[model samples]
Target: MATVSMSVNGKLVSRDIDPRTLLVDFLREHLRLTGTHVGCDTTQCGCCTVHVDGKAMKSCTLLAIGLEGAQITTIEGLAKGQELHPMQAAFREHHGLQCGFCTPGMIMAAVDMVNRKGNHLDDQTIREELEGNICRCTGYHNIVKAIHSGAEAMGAAK
Candidate 1:
């Protein structure tokens, strides 16, 4: 086992974890942050997406021990008490989710997309950017709308 330390959702966490443990497991199993889902352990689904040092990354693709001292943000970190983050609020308002299995990761990925692409994302750009995240229920129409609105909201906040 190897000792790993990192800042998760603004909280400092340290644990003795197996060297082979994936970051998604570390968050869900160790920290009890189940918001980060694991749709595909192979990193194709993007359900294990999280913010690593403010950048979106697939948690299942990263090793827990390789992320010592990293600043991570799960979907649980996006809200402030009862208030939701802009991306989350947009997802809710736009009805972007159906079964909700991919909502958490989609919201997290949207936030990162807005951060990079700014608020002026066109529909085509939104679709292209979200190719990595797969949502089987929604057909991605509402998801695109949500990202556009969320990106605008984030820009307004800034």
Candidate 2:
């Protein structure tokens, strides 16, 4: 086991974990942050996405030890107090999800995309960037709408 120290959801956390434990498992099983989901065994599914030092990352692709000294943000940390993050609210208002299994990671990825690209995201650009994620339902129409609406809401708030 390796002792790793990192910040999670704005809280400092240090724990002992097997070096092989994936960051997703560490967050869910250890920290009880179950919002992060794993929809595919392979990393192709964006369902396991998280923010590492403000950048989007597939949590399943990185080992817990590999995240040492990094600041990680999961879906649970995206809001402040009782307020919903614009992305989350937009998804809710736009009906962006179906089964909802992929919502958390999708929102995280969308937020990361907008944070990096802003409201100027074109449909093709959004589709290209979101290729890493797969949604079995909604045919991606609502997803794209949600991203755009979320971007608009975020822009308006700023």
Task: Estimate the Cα RMSD of every predicted model relative to the unseen true structure.
Answer: 0.6, 0.9
Clashes of 1: 0
On a 0 to 100 scale, what is the lDDT of residue 74 in model 1? 95
The residue-by-residue lDDT of candidate 1 on 1-158, one tens digit each, is 98999999999999999999999999999999998999978988889999999999999999999999999999999999999998899999999999999888898889998888888899999889888899999999999999999999989987
* TM-score, cand. 2 vs. native: 0.97
The residue pairs that clash in candidate 1, if any, are none
- Local error of candidate 2 at residue 38 (angstroms): 1.0
Worst 10 residues of 2 by lDDT: 119-128
lDDT of each: 0.93, 0.91
In model 2, where do residues sit more than 4 Å from their true spots? none
Give one digit per residue, the lDDT tens place, for model 2 in 1-158: 88999999989999999998999999999999999998895998889999999999999999999887999999999898899999999899989999998899889999999999987788888888899888999889899989988988999989
Candidate 1 has its poorest 10 consecutive residues by lDDT at: 111-120
Candidate 1 error regions (>4 Å): none
| TM-score on alpha carbons, each prediction | 0.98, 0.97
The CA lDDT at 36 in model 1 is 93
TM-score of 1: 0.98
